[model samples]
Structures are given as structure tokens and as C-alpha cells.
Target chain A: MGEFRMPSLGADMAAGTLVAWRKQPGDVVHRGDIIAEVETDKGVIEVEVFDEGVVETLLVAVNAKVPVGTPLASIASAGSIAAVPSAPSPVQAPPPAAARVHATPLARTVAKALGVDVTKVHGTGDGGVIVRADVDRAAAEVTSTPRPDRMRQAIAAAMTRSKREIPHFYLAHTVDLGPALTWLSARNEARSVTDRVLPGALFVRAVARAARAVPELNAHWTGESAPPLPYVHVGVAVALRGGGLVAPAIHDTDTLDVDGVMRAMADLVDRARGLKLTATEMGEATITVTSLGDRGVEVNVPVIVPPQVAIVGFGKVVDRPWVVAGVVVPRPVVTISLAADHRVTDGHRAGRFLASVVAFLEDPEKP
Target chain B: MKREDIEAVVIQKLAKAAPGTDPGSLDRDEAYRDALDLDSMDFLRFVDALHEALGVDVPEAHYPKILTIRACTAYLEAVLAKR
Candidate 1:
């Protein structure tokens, strides 16, 4: 039997409310299938399971808020159930039917820990089986604790942990956006509005390409420093209309062209605002990029999301004096800043990464 | 299409692109960002909807020229007349 645990969608999430299950018992499941919908601070994320198996049971009830890493279901691994017991199954002994209560093991454990009588706890699982949610609900009814905003609380805990653990180094560079804007304008001169690329997408692509050149900066700071990722997943920070922000990854962003990046970014941003992001999109980023250029902020130093070692931020682009070829001239410039985990990389390496980003933008024709 | 007809199409598309936006209250000469709270993505979708609805192709070079309600209608009127 294989256990399917609740996925950690982000570093900040300690628990998520299981909104619904997409699969039921006896269903054949494959890798990468969205098995459940989990509501987090980011939104209702479609949670994907990573193993191939037949679902044996759903361990958590819908609307239950459980901690991350709690097993949500049990599944029979593929090819593991083909051999049946020929005779009386001498190796295994069946429990007496009188003591058998249709309850998940995790639920029974919780009941024991909380000193709650298992027989009295209401069951809401398949065939009236007690699940973790029943214990949680029973506990809640007894304690009457006020429900806090789980998403907000999770984000706070994660950010606090990130700040406490990671030693972050900050660097900023003012890059001339004149060449990039001119190239983009020329490219879009004949295209329709929907087909035109946005500057935010351009920054994402540029940052990805830069990370490729300076591979050291594109990494996660897991206990031992793992090698830089072979491909880049650039997380674009999108502001939700209501209140919170989410930065979902655009997978393999460096390999895509500007137009491709723009399309992916638009789709991701739209879906993110609607709370329809998948688990892969939520947790797969190697690095993150945040842009507030539209808001007209000149410079910003964004915090690093945990596990990921680096974050890049862009501020408002405005025309300013530039010394090109030793002569000062008016040109559009934007401040690009990098917040990197000092444990994995130093300021010198980060400087190279930032410069590479600027270099790509300066020659927008390349990527 | 008449100028009124073009304006109606524009307003309808804007209203659909941005929910809760009062298209009827939009100032003809005010920027959509200030008047309708339409961001760049929403504005782009509005322009695309206009093309899809009325067959008016808005070239990127003319984006600034058609940023406001009055300007968009005027530009669309000229393009439709030519077509």
C-alpha cells in the first residue's frame, strides 16, 4: 500500500483545507493526476499526486483543515495486488468483527491522542468510516476555537521562517530599457493588441536566460547545496485583485521565446487570480521574479521565498540621464534588484546574474 | 458603423472585460486606467474583443491614440468607414 500525503504547495503553508477529492476508491490513478483540490492562502489549488496506484481509501473528509504532510489517502501500488491468497491466507489473521470499527488508522490515532472515544466520533467517510476530519470536527465542536484565516496564518509562518533561517544578500542595478522597448515596439508595430508581449513577460524571459548563464544563482538551498537546476522554472509574482499575491512558476521559461512567455504569463496570471492554479505551478519554481514597474515604484528589495535561494525584482521604468559612450543622454531606465541567499551564493555571483539579465534586455533581439 | 454604434461596441466590450466597471459612466477623454480601473491585461482583452466583435483590427502603433473612449471610437469610426 502507498500513502498519499497532502502536498506542501508553498513554503509558508502548514495546513490546507481539503476542498474536494477528484478520485474515489477503486479508481485507477496515474502520475501527475490532480487528485484533490486544496484551499490555501494563494487560493484553491488543484493538488496533483505523484505516484501511480489504485486508490484504496480517502483518508480525509472534505472541508477538513489538516497539517501538511498528513496522509490524505491510501492507494494499492500498481502490480502489487495481483497475487491473491490461495487458501486461508495463513500469513494474515483477520480481526474479530465485533471490535472492527470502520475508521482510518490516522483517525484512530488522532482519537487516541486527543482522548476522544472512537465509537462516539461521527463517521463521514465511505461506508460510514471515520476519517481524520471526523476527529477534527469532533475536537472542534468540543473546544469551540475560533477559526483563523489559515492561508494568512500559513504565509506569516513561512515568511517568518524564511527571514529567520535564510541570510539574504541584496543587490540592485539600474538598467537602460531604451533598447529593449524600442525593439519590442518595432516588433509589435504591425501586431494586434492581444498578440503583443507585455514588459513583465519580457523580464521573466530575460531573467531566465540570465540564470542559465550564471547557473549558480538558479538553485535551491536545501541542507547540502544541490547542483543548479538543468532547466529554469521562473515564478512570476502576480497580485490578486482581492488582497493576496501568488508567484507561480512558468516551467522551462528559458527555452521559450518572448511571445511564448507572454502567453504563458497571461494564462497563469488569469488562472491565479481565479484561484485555479495547480500544485505543480505553486511549488516547482527554482527562482522567482517580482515586477512592480506598472505601479511606478522606482526600486524595491523583495524577500526570498524559502527553499528557493534567489528572487529578482523590477521597479518602474522611467526616462533618466544615461552616460553612453561617455556622453550623458536621456534614456528609459528601470531598477533591477536581486535578493539571494548568502549561504548558497555571494554578492559577486549575484552581480553577474543581474548583469546578465541587463545584458539580455540591452540586446532584446537575442531572446 | 456610425460613431455611436462603434462607441456602444467599445463600451460593451469594456464592460465584459472588467466586471463591476460602469461602461456608461466612462469619460470619453479620460484614460481607461483612471476611469474604468482597467489594467494593461484587461485593456488588451478589451481591444481584442473589439476586433472579434466588430472586425476592427487595432495595430499596436495606435494603442496610445485609442486609449480613451472618445479616441477609440473616433479611430474605429475611421477604420470602419474605410472598410
Candidate 2:
């Protein structure tokens, strides 16, 4: 039997509340299937199972808050001996509701005061016991709790840690988008609205391709000497309609074309705004791209989200005078900026990655 | 379609793409990104909605020309006239 522990969605996430479970005991589970929905600092994330097996038992009850590495469930892997006999079917009458409801003394009092059924509320206390906070939360459900406030606090904590530990180096390159714009126009002219590609998507693809090309910049600086990730999953930073922002990965972005990236980006942004991001999407980013240019800023210096060595940012694409082969001319230009961890890689390697992105954007047909 | 009709369609589409945008208060001649706080993805979705509504293909080259509410309606009118 293998224990499925609560996964750390990022370096900042310490604990998560088990909101719901998709699979129950005796249910067959695949490696990538979402077995539970976990409410973390980021948001409520669809927690995926990394083990393929039959779920033996769900250890943690719904709404239980557990720290990272707490075993959420146990899976009986295929080919393992089913040696242990199942417990004898309960022959006696079910226990009384008060006897069955394992709750703390404070929780019992709070539940009584609020006229709440303690048995109905899932407990986060020791050995699946109800707590006072759980009772308070159950009582507050009628009043409606705001979601983003907690998420904002979580982001603040994570970004704070990122700035504290990661010694970051910043680099900016102004890429002329004249050729890219011309190429994109020709490509988009023939495509339908659904099939048309956006420049943002193109940039994501370029960044992914560039990360693949420059392997040094595509890694996590965990202080431990770990090997680089085998593939690039570029996280696109999306601002939520409510308040906070989330940067979720479009998995294996290097393999996707601009059209594919565009669709993925649109879907991600929509889901992110809708507050439905999965844990795997939140955890799988090898790098992040934030295009603040949509608000018309020319450039932005970004903070590196910890562990991930680099972040790519883009400012607004605007008409500007540029030098092409020693001649000044008007062209659509975007400032591409990179914030990389100096501990993982130097400015030279980051520059190369940025150059690759610029080159790819300039000749997107070849990217 | 009349310019008003086109503008109405554009505004409806914009409102749909961005849930909280108030089309009534928007400046007709100001850039939609500035006026509506629309990102590229939001703008693209708005364009997609327009294409679905009008069945007119707004090419990438015309994005800048039709960035404002007034310009988008005028551009759509010209496209409809040509068609």
C-alpha cells in the first residue's frame, strides 16, 4: 500500500484543506486522475494521484486541513498481495450520532451555539475530529465567505519568500515585431476566428522553444543540486477578474503550435478567472511568462517566483522608431524582460534564452 | 448593418468577453485597451465574438485600425459595405 500525501503545489504552500474527494475506497485510479480537490493558499486545486492502483482507503475526511506530506489516502498497487482480510461487516447497530461524531469540546460548544450538526461538518482536527474553526466556517456558509482574500495572502507570502531567497538578475531586450507582425498577419488572414493565433500565444511558444534550446535557464534553483527538468511547461500569468493573479502552466508548451498555445492560454485564463485551476497545472511550471503589456506598460521588472529559476515578462507592443541594418524606421516593438536566479544561471545564459525568444518571435514561421 | 447596430454588437460582445465592463461609460474614440482595460486575449475573444456575430473576418493587419469603439464600428461598416 502506498500513501498519497498532500502535495505541495508550490514552495509557499504548507498545508491544504481537503475540500472533496472524487474517488472512494475500492475505486480504480490512474496516475494522473484527480482524486481530491484541495483548498490551498493559491485556491481550490484539483489534486491528482500519481500512483496507479485501487484506492484502499481515504485517510483524510473532507474539509480536513493537513500539512504537506500528510497521507491523504492509501492505494493498493496492482500485483500487490491482497493478503489482509477485510474487516468483518458491522453486525451491531450503528453507533449513536453523538458517539459517532468525534469532535473537540470547543467544537461541540460552538456547534451547539450555532445550531449546527457537528456530524455533518467534516473535521480537520486530530484523527478526523471536528474543530471550533470548522464549526465557525460551517456557520459562516450562509453569510458567504470571500475566496480571494486568502488567496491574496498566500500570494504575498510566496512572493515575499521568492524575493528574500532568490538573488535575481534582470535583463531586457527590445525586439522589433515588424517581421513577426507581417508574418502573423499573413498566417491569420486565412484562418477563422477560432483558429486565429494571438501574439501572446506566439510569445509563449517562443519562450518554451527558447527554454528547450537553452537548457541552463530551464530549471529550479532548489539550493540542492538537482538535474534540470526534461521538458518545458511554461506558466502564463493571468490576472483574475476578482482581485489576485495565478500563473498556471500550459503543459509541454514547446510541443504546441501557436494556435494550440492560443487555445490553451484562452482556456487557462478563463478557468483561472473562474477559479478552477488544478494542482498539477499550478505545480508543473518550469518557467513563467507575464505579459503586462495588455495594460499598455512599455516594460516591467519582474520578481522570480521561487524554485523556478526564471521569469519572462513583456510590455505593450507599440509603434516605435528602430534601427534595422543602420537605418532608422518605424516598427511595432515589444520589450522582453527576463528575471533569472543568479544562483542557477548567469546573465549570459539568460540573455541567450531571451535572444532565442526574440529570434523565434521575429521568424515565428520557423519557431 | 448600420454603424449603431455594429457598435451595439461590438459593445455586447465586449461586455460578454469581459463581464464587468460598462459599455455605456466607454469613450468611443479612446483605445479599447485603455478604455475597457482589455488584454490581448480579451481583445482577441472580443474579435472572435464579433466574427461569429457578423461573419466578417477582421484580419490581423486591421487590429490597430479598429482598436477603438468608433474605429471598430467604422471598419466593420466598411467591410459590410464592401461585401
Candidate 3:
């Protein structure tokens, strides 16, 4: 018998949601066959089986959130759980009459530590046996302490690693927006109140264009100093309820149309504010931009997301004075600050990126 | 295509599609935002126009290439040339 456990994709991931099962029990599985879809912060990824085996028992159900090293299923040629290393998670323990209820190697170790009757705790693990969590939970209940859930631990590790390792360089530029404000006011007046164009939508478009102009800023930076990616997968930061943060990438904002971008932004914002994002959507961000303009943070130096080379911070749009062809004029200007990875991009490139972003914002209609 | 010609075409198209942008006197190869005021909305509009003008789809896989006016123009040109 062999144990099929969930492998940890990264240091940040503790548990993964089994989105779907590609393979079923009793069907023979070969190595490299896509067995399941696991949701991690990076998005939905196909999980492949490593060894060829006969599926003996299905240990976990689809859509279940199972921890790393958990036995997703078990494979065997005959009635045996003794051959596998261990089974480490709970499942719907099978009928007792079908198989011998023996504790797995790890389960026996955990059972010895907990002193719980492994047979009595109910072997929900593969082949009707106790696993690590059953023993730990049984032990915890008696001890009166619950472990921190998998989500919390994963989030902590990702954020901590991002903060410590990435060296960030900050660049800020104030947009001169006399013409842009003029254009916006006229455009709003021309359209019905119900159909007025979105300034927020316009800003998103601007960032997309700016990144395109300074293409180098669009990719994620490898911490070990590898070259950045050529394409830009833009991440939009949205504040969730209860005051936490999650930045979900819009896939390719640089390539989407205004309407498409508007819809995507709205959908992602709604999800980031709620619970709609899959682990895959949350995980793979090439670059991210934040909008705290609603919250009134004028200038923010956000930390560079690991693997991502830069993050743009958007702040409040307020009226300010500016020069137009040597004439002083008033305008509704906003501050755009870019936090870039110093290791991959220089100040010259960063400045150009910010400048391009400012230009895009000032005239989003420009093709 | 010469860099200048590509930049001019980008400026002309952007002005027609979204207006109120100044395609400054900087070198044509200068980045779009550095030489002109075409924010994200303008950028999106530009992409839409590029698709319409080039008769080429900016499929999900090709989106990352729409970075600069020259780059965008070159992509459009390549897609059109291939067609």
C-alpha cells in the first residue's frame, strides 16, 4: 500500500483546497496523471500523482480543504496499510468489516504520544485507521488548546518573507492634470449621470498603459537576482472587510479594454472584499497596484511583493496648482508612487515607469 | 518601420480615440506616458483601437506585450503582417 499525501507547493502554503478530483478510486493511476485540482494562493493548479498504483481507497472528498502531508487517498495491491509510510489526516473511515483497522506508522507514533485509544477515536484515515490530526485534536481537547488554523499560518509566512527579503526602492511623481480634469468634467457633463465614466476605471487603464510604455516594470523580480518576466500580470490591491488586505491580479490589465478592465476591476474588488477569489488568483502576481485614494493616503511606500518587481500606490485626487505652457493653473492632481525592486530595476527605469503612468492617467482616451 | 513613424501613428490614433492628450516634442521612441498624457483609460481605449485597426485579437496569451506605443504598434504590425 502507498499513501498519496498533499505535497507543499511553497513554504507559505499549509493547506490546499481540493477543487476537483480528476481520478477516482478503483481506477488504476499512473505516475504524472493529473489526479486533482488544488487551490493555492497562486490559483488552481493540477496536482499529479508520482507513482503508479491501484487505487485502494478514496481518503478525501472534492472541495475539501486538506492540510499539507494529509493522505488524499491510498493505493494497494491487496489488504495492506503496513507498507506505506503513514496516513496523516482524517477521512470517512471505511466499514470495519472490509479491512483490518490498523494504525499507520505515523498514526501509531502520534497515538503513543497522545495516549488516546487509536481504535476508539475512529480510524477516518486510509483503510480505517487513526492519523496525526485525530491524535493531536484528541490530545488538544484534553489539553484545552487549539492550534492556529492553516490559513493564518500560511498568510503570516508569506507576508513575513515578502517584508524581510525584498529590497524596495521608492519613486513618487505628482501628475499635472489641468487638461485631464478639464477632459473629465466635460466628458462627465456630456454623458448622462447614470452613464458617467469612472475615474477609478480611468486610473486603472492609465496604469496599464504606463506599464506597457515601461515594459520592464510589468514583471515580478526573482529574489536570487534572476531576470524579470517580459509580460505584466497586474495585481489590484483591495481592502477586505474586517480591515485586512488581499491583492488579486487582473491577469493582464495591459491587454484588456476599458470596459473589460472596468468589469474585471469591479469583480476582483468585490471578491477581494469578500470570499470569491480562488487560491490561484491570489497567488501569482507579476506586479500589483494599490488604490488607497478612497482612504486618503496621499503617498504610500508599499512593500514589493516577492517575485513581483514593483507595486504602484494610488492616493487621493485633490486640487492643486500646476504650470501649463509657462502659465500657472489649478488642476485636480493625484500622486502615484511606485515601489520597485532595486535589485532588478534602476532609478532611471523606475522614474520612467512612474512618468508613463502619470501620462496615461492624464489622457486615458489617447490610443 | 522607423521608430518615428510608429510613434506618430500611435499619437494620431490616441488623439482620435480619446483626445485631450499632448503628444509632446520628445523623441518618438520616448515612452508613451513620458511624452504624452494618456492614462490607463486612454491606454485601454488605445488597445481597443489597435485591435479594431489591426484586425487582430489581443488574446489572453498576448496581453503582456501591450506595454509601449512602439511595442504595441510593432505587435499590431506583426499580427497584421502575419495575417
Which candidate do you rate higher for lDDT, 2 or 3? Answer: 2
Model 2, A247-313: lDDT tens digits are: 9999999999888998899899887765567888898799999988877789978888777989999
TM-score of 1: 0.79
TM-score of 2: 0.81
Candidate 3: docking tier: incorrect
DockQ of the two-chain complex in candidate 3: 0.02
Going through the candidates in order, the fraction of native interface contacts each one reproduces equals: 0.58, 0.84, 0.00
Index of the highest-TM-score prediction: 2
TM-score (0 to 1) of chain B, per candidate? 0.92, 0.93, 0.62
Any idea what lDDT model 1 has?
0.80
Candidate 1: residue pairs that collide:
none
Which runs of model 2 end up more than 4 angstroms from their true locations? A80-148, B1-9, B24-32, B64-83
Model 1 chain A is weakest, by summed lDDT over 10 consecutive residues, at A84-93
Best model per DockQ: 2
Candidate 1: segments with Cα more than 4 A from true spot: A78-155, A223-227
Better of 1 and 3 by DockQ: 1
